[model samples]
Target: MGKSDCSKLHIAMFPWAAYGHFIPFLHLSNKLAQKGHKISFLLPRGVQPKLENLNQFPSLIQFFPLLLPCVDGLPPGAETTSVVPLNQQKYLAFAVDQTRDQVESIFKVIKPDIVMYDFWFWIPDLARQLGIRPITYVVVSSMSAAYNTTMITKETTVEEAMELPPGYPSSTVRFKDEEAPIVLSMARDFGSGLTFYQRINTTFTQSDAIAFRTCREIEGPFLDFVAQGFRKPVLLSGPSFPETKTKQLDDKWVNWLSKFEPGSVVFCSFGSQSELQKDEFHFQELVLGFELCGLPFLVALKPPQGCSTVEEALPEGFEERVKGRGLVYGGWVPQELLLHHPNIGCFVNHCGYGTMWEFLLTDCQIVLIPEIGDQILNTRLMVNELKIGVEVERGKNRQVSKESLSEAIKFVMDKDNETANKLRANRAKLKQTLSNRDVQEKYINSFIQALQDLVKK
Candidate 1:
């Protein structure tokens, strides 16, 4: 491969069934296509309709949609993880595995230069068998990835199993023995005979190269940890800032947000994948946290199972009393636009990677109330590592109290305390760097250069 070879690289994008995983791959594909490379984005037929940015890229980017195979437990036409309930995600994985023959056939026809995939860790084996290079596109933070790899890649003795990993931040944060259940559950619900952690190890070992949605400026040490641990070419895919070119906002939401003063409203959301119904008391505390702060708020509420309406989901008279100050909508809202709005002063979030990047794009302060998966790790990065946000203290049962939530909100929103002022200033600096178009482009270009270099070997 020579310098001129960069122009003709045919890349195949096969992301996991979840929207969080799919969106980053889409962004990367668009970037690759812009550089005169051909991109074949493979996804299920049902997912194709949900991609609003499909037409934004050049014609070089082609969508190769496949009909999803039905599994016994999975609902009909439920191709993406977003449509499937949280508990039933494993069925989607089973369905995706069933498409092995179909995907292999597409590979034979298109004969892509490289196949870039997410979470479907078995793809590297298939790509090798087909004589095409394989790339693993990791969507989580480097710290989360490193921690997970350290925990799962080797057999652990009884003592090591109960303790946090050697290099983990023990003083700042530690995983309790009880928390083992949470980590273990991610491995349990996968469709493959191998656990999800095992798949991650396999993917790292099998792929030609690995790419992450991060840059060295923010996560240098953790990225180095992964590179050294895996002993492979770990590429930085930038934050893959989502293209906001197609800004679609509903008139109802726009009109509603207009009433509040600039940087005064709190936007609350916990992304699509989280099962937010821990307990009724927990839900009440979350509502009261906003009211106690006396801030105008907008909540994109996804009610727990069996609760159809927000009124039924929340406490009685809760909506009626907060009618003027808060609005609770039960469906989709343009989150990108809402977060960018002038009135949104704080984002009370579940600390998902996708949502974290969205908050970093704005000057809004983050109020981390992490629930599951890598969210706790992400929250620690924001709160302890970066000093950009405040974390609300959860009680013995990992439930947030209203008082603690209010305190965390004020710590970010008020800016009266020196600590709060420093956090805001630091966040402003990060916002400048993370939101820079040129910086993100540089990372993307470097990744392509690395990929081009890999082909030569």
Candidate 2:
């Protein structure tokens, strides 16, 4: 099948009930739609309003709402992981899984050519029952995906998982024993006596192929390893890098960043998934860090619900002291767009896969300060494997100190620094690699062709 063969295909997308998962699937849907294919994007009611570009291609893209099922301990408004607190995530996962019947009903009505899903472990079986083949779409680094699939399914002791996989490069990058249980716990057995790992293994096994939100150039080895280990076709769908258009920054932000030279400001954000501890010590440390680094910084942070202003969240006179040196905007800011701005030099990011792609596509120096979950592994890819970024040193408790943060900022943004120059050069090459429209199209077309072939069989 050629590129034109995909025009008649109808693709149904159901991502895990998390913004991180949903957004990537949406990007793929848009790509497929642009090629004249039909896309039915399944979104829970609560998250529908948060989606952008609904009217961009009204005819090709359609939203199909799946009402979140009621489950004990899951709040009514909590449909996406962004809204749910971290501690109660298990309940949210359980609730999302209960939507299986609703999904099946929708599939019967739509009768899609193929169904693509992320982290919905039950999707493969459901698609089979409905006479439609399912494809597992993983929105993570290929190594992380392969590691989880391999380690989680097999009943290996934590000690066994500590050692780096035999063929992987760098023995220093092995998983810590303490991190294994938390990773495994995220994969609830759901009465199947299998960890979340087994569920994913089974799902991927049932599918003819697995689709990843990554390209082969950066992770060719891990991709090959997963395919060989699992004995299934592994397909790359390309990195869904953001399409950056010059967006006008707010006057306040623009005015502050104007004082700094091009590539001198550090943009720090921890995304919506995690938050800095709302305490005097942590807040004071960040202020001191920025001051010591002497780099003008823009931080996007949301104060806790009870706090009315950024001042209430920070230490006394903190804002006054750093008035000209930095910015602390409460709530939203256009992050990807800001990264494209000439004045912004460095990004202190949480290392979410989505954010990682944004950082990769831009010239901004990366200073990874990952908070939780897969971000730690994502950091490893950036700092250890790719060698495009530096990670800040954290204390034994994983709390980063002001001194360490300051040093990291200086290491990346300092003009005469050799290591910093090399990182920028590597990042420029990566940006060029990711910018090839033909390369992206080729990957998407190949993925579509594979889907077409799967459906035909």
Candidate 3:
């Protein structure tokens, strides 16, 4: 079979419908395709057209668009998590669970050597029946994954998880008292006939091996902990870096950015997930923070909840007060790609795991303001553990004030200050480590070799 030639093996990938999971799976598929392996990428029908431009190796990687079946409680035409809000996303997952037969049919026909997936815990059992290996690949850090898996079992209580487990890899990794409810929410039924906790636990327990989009350099201790705890091989695919081919920035952005001095503009983005509610002590204050910082800034966010447009949500005279120096666009932009611009010296973001890897590779000073979930933990990894950034200070109730947010931005931007210099120097060192092409190559190559050995077994 294809096991004889690992380079020519066929693989299939099915990630959770969210962009956070889907994009990283595609990026991994692209890496495999570059090494002469073929990928059958299965995603929702509508999402296919959206991700067309990112399919750099179209000839070697084919997209099989599956129409998500309808489920009760899910709104009409809502297939992905991005379309439906978090609370209603359980219905979307219910619809995905209904696709089991369709997925099995495709697997039987393709007979892939290995199948990789994030959610859908039933996948490992299905692959075994079809005599194919199944690997659960997570996009989150091993630190997050290991900690969550240990502390969030099916029998876990909200009160129990509020305290750190008896023995964790790092004491630096902690859950806040106020964050207990959000953490406990994982136990809620997610409509896939499983709670979020059960689904994740089952995936790890059933999969032949677990893989992560991380390197030992960044998460060595946590990786070891996961391997020992799960009693399975843990493969590292390393971090995905920007490829040589780059997307051209728009003329308007180029012209505007060129007018500013090098390393002077603040580029703000919160990924493609949330439309921040204006009153969560998030949107308006964050907008005013950039204004208060007096930096030339570009903030790309959806119009806040309760407002029809970004212009409508701004504080009184906010538009006029920072007329030429600021912008708050209500649409998606190439903000991640723009990190290369010399004029973009500061990055303000939610510290998303994938985005953290991205910003870590760039020279821009990081300022974090995580909204919810593991993002807060990722911020701790950045601000406390790595010491490569500063976080916007949170109050007793975890709310961030305009002045505190502004101070975090200004702290990173102060080039002459000793603390700022240390942050930059630490960031530069980490960037060099991640940017080591040889190191990254070995991780991917070793990952593929692990798959071949598993198939042979």
Candidate 4:
């Protein structure tokens, strides 16, 4: 397709309000804008601050706000990106419903040629109602898509999922003895997991195409499985890396990082929205373990609601023991910027899809500590299948001891280990394959060409 042909296309992008979902959609949006397609980004109001600087793209891209119904203790006018109590499943459902309403309203006004959405259930029906084609974007690895589709079904109870699938990677697949059944039931009953899998299957069964943020080179086995078995039009767009014009570091954080030797500091952050209670003794064990390692680290610590102080979230005198060796932030950090810094040796992460891609692109070693969701599966792949990282073992109480946490950190940071070096080399090869801009552009352009052909029909 020619540049002039691309200029005539209009695309609307809607992503789930969470950071992990929003960031990748934003990356795709930027790429589309660069290709001369008119792009409209629909997001909840809470994301405005983070998206404010996006206004610079005055010509090709525009942002619109969606209003969400307010709940008590949620900031007034909180949109999809706002942080809420994790336990509030009812509130999260309400937010998703509000997002659907807002998206429909905008679609009516814009009447775009195509609508691209994060894997949300309401989208397929909405697209049908509007006489437009919906493209579902799966943000995780292709393996995740296969696992969720094959394992989750109406007949598959939580108890059954507790047993590892044939050739499943982890010995830790079963939860602690007492909690195993409960965890299985939670996995089965969790509305989001069921909804996500259902939507993905439905979209594969119905949509014009399914788009994924993975290249065939990185996920050939799983991608082949989906294509040969499902026979859907699937496009393997490359990793949607963050594209910002600036590389400036946060001065305060850089100064703190400078105190440590080159490649000596470990960067620890579970992407935003993964929070734990202040009084949870597990929090203290994690802190004590980091202290015991005596590594210079930078941590992003967000205290749970009603925990009025940072001191309440940590072990007593924890900051004093670590002294100037550690720096903790109360709120969000520019993660891509931090990861690309020369001083960061390894990452301790919750293994969100976006963070994993960033870690891969930068060729950094990782220590996976997943708290929930598809993350559990992603952690398994990181350690057992890819051998690129390590996972921490937790006890029956769902907490890691100071001893276990300390040992896991030491294992990941040990430079002389043969396994670690092999993993690093594997990651370097993956990075080289994905760094090809020309190949990435071809996949994206081909997808766009297919959409253009659909418009003529």
TM-score: model 3 vs. ground truth: 0.96
lDDT tens readout by residue for model 3, 123-160: 99999999988999999878777766653655677778
lDDT of 3 at 61: 92
Tens digit of per-residue lDDT, candidate 1, span 260-376: 899989998877765456254366668877778778999776776567766677767878888889987778777878888888898988889888888888889889987776887
Global local distance difference test of model 1: 0.79
**Between which residue pairs do clashes occur in model 2?**
none
Query: Which RMSD values do the candidates have, in order?
Result: 2.6, 2.6, 2.1, 3.6
Kindly report which residue stretches of model 4 are placed more than 4 angstroms away from their true locations once superposed.
4-7, 70-76, 98-105, 151-156, 163-204, 228-230, 279-281, 304-306, 453-457
Per-residue accuracy of model 2 over 327-411 as CA lDDT, tens digit each: 8877788887788889999998779988988888888999987765478788887887778999888776566788999999998
Clashes of 3: 0
CA error at residue 298 for candidate 1, angstroms:
1.3
**Candidate 4 global Cα RMSD:** 3.6
TM-score of each: 0.93, 0.92, 0.96, 0.86
Name the weakest run of 10 consecutive residues (lDDT summed) in model 1. 153-162
Can you rank all candidates by TM-score, best first? 3, 1, 2, 4
lDDT of each: 0.79, 0.77, 0.85, 0.69
Q: What is candidate 2's TM-score against the reference?
A: 0.92
Report the lDDT tens digits of candidate 4 across residue range 1-457.
4555644678887776676777777787777777777888877766867875654455888888777776554555555444554444435545665567778888899888887776466677897798777777778776666554444554656556555445433354323344444334334322344533454566565666677888777666667666654676677667755454576887987888888787778788877676656555355666777777778888776765467555677777888878888766667798888888888887888888778887887756788777765677667666766677888887766677777776777776778988778878887887777677777778777767776776667
